[model samples]
Target: MAGLRARLKKTIVLVGMMGAGKTAVGKALAARLAVPFLDSDREIVKAASATIAEIFVRDGEAFFRDRETEVITRLLNAQASVLSTGGGAFLAAHNRQVISDAGVAVWLQADLDLLWSRVRHKNTRPLLRTANPRETLAELYKTRDPLYALADLRVSCGADYSIDDMATAVLEVLKSRPDVLEISRDG
Candidate 1:
């Protein structure tokens, strides 16, 4: 929606597992389309002055999730932009409804092994803080797969795909939905 860049008629929300590259790919996609890139998790941390893990440890996941829903609903209703949501953001029916109403949700589908490899070393994910984090991640993956599939669109990723590659793939998929997104050229 800026300059000669692509025009986004609605918000584009990236939703998936922790290591699904939502924030990384969302930033690239927003830059490619010349739109704002906003991460709900980052916004939450900024507002609460604490990390997600800290929030979960203090106020609990339920509180963090409540804040997540509020931030997501507010961002989705803002100007057209790229919104990268938390992994569990779409698992909630209320958040899903809000996203569906004001934006297009894109699930960055990736296999569990790839997701594990990407997130195994991250201490920021409170959900994976278990005796067997890998097993926990697998459980989360299995439980959330069906929910993530309910997204408006899906963009598959692999160990070989880079952030730019995923962004390009998402753009290719978005090209078909001219009502939501459109490529523009200036004379």
Candidate 2:
């Protein structure tokens, strides 16, 4: 049987709601760990040759989600890397299963206040294209938090924290969890 440390060394995947700082933390974490970083949403945008808003306006959410799954699958099959997924990436059971099987998933958590502070100005989030952005964010957070908890690790990503600080904290947590690290390495 593969050791825990080996199974968990494959990749570090950051999963959380938007404004939880997945991209920022994933980049910092990858740099700290000396690995490449990939944002699944960015990959999807590049592949579709369209922004997320455009995708939602044209192809709709289901189409965009299918594309997202494809991008995530490819990323998981790649070499060692840090992957940051969209807010909704882990909501799908298939996507979550892929993440669980292919990498160590970390959930960067923040309360509604922190999330509103970070994303209130971000016009790019398709889900936030609403009359009441804060309410939408709160609703999304309520739905996503439970799914995020399904990840292998969870870290509080408060507004007071820096990406580097969060990255270090995640590393510390991963280091202490030899069983998870082993799963990622050997997966």
Candidate 3:
């Protein structure tokens, strides 16, 4: 797939755990396809003029989620780009519907251990600010796995997969459906 031009006809919305590398992989995927990259979390922060943690602390998770849903809708309506969503965004049924209708939802599945190793040092995740964050993440994983499984595509994430590697993996999977992805010569 190297040096091939891939067209993302519909948005490629990444869904999964926080440490599953959605942002990194999304950027790589967008760059590889020569399309715009958008992160739903970043868009929410920009719209609210505050960090996600600050929004949660000031308003609440519900308010923040409302803003998340709105941002997802607005972005989907705005353009077809590589979009990385917050870990919890797909947990909302309405969000799932909106994404399903407008784009291909790819779940970047990673083991709990892998996810923990990636996010343990990060203070950016508000949901993991608890005293027992690993336990909380495990719980979230157990519940969200079923929902994430509802995605249009699934890519397993492991220590061996680099950001570009994951992006290529996504393209390989997309090969099955040319309606969603079309590849041509770079020049």
Tens digits of per-residue lDDT for model 2 on 1-187? 2232333367788988888899989998777666788999999989889999999999999999999999999999988689999999899999989988988788998888988988998788889989998998888988878888999888997777888789878877787666545334443
Which is superior by lDDT, 1 or 3? 1
State model 3's lDDT: 0.93
- Report the C-alpha lDDT of model 3 over 17-135, residue by residue, as the tens digit: 99999999999989878889999999999988999999999999999999999999999987679999999999999999999998889999999999999999999999999999999
Model 2 is weakest, by summed lDDT over 10 consecutive residues, at 1-10
- Estimate the TM-score for candidate 2: 0.90
lDDT of 3 at 173: 90
What TM-score do all the candidates reach, one by one? Answer: 0.96, 0.90, 0.96
- Model 3 residue 109 CA deviation (Å) reads 0.4
Ordered from best to worst lDDT, the candidate numbers read: 1, 3, 2
Off by over 4 Å in 3: 185-187
Candidate 3 TM-score over all chains jointly? 0.96
User: Would you list the C-alpha lDDT of every candidate in the order shown?
Assistant: 0.93, 0.85, 0.93
Off by over 4 Å in 1: 1-5
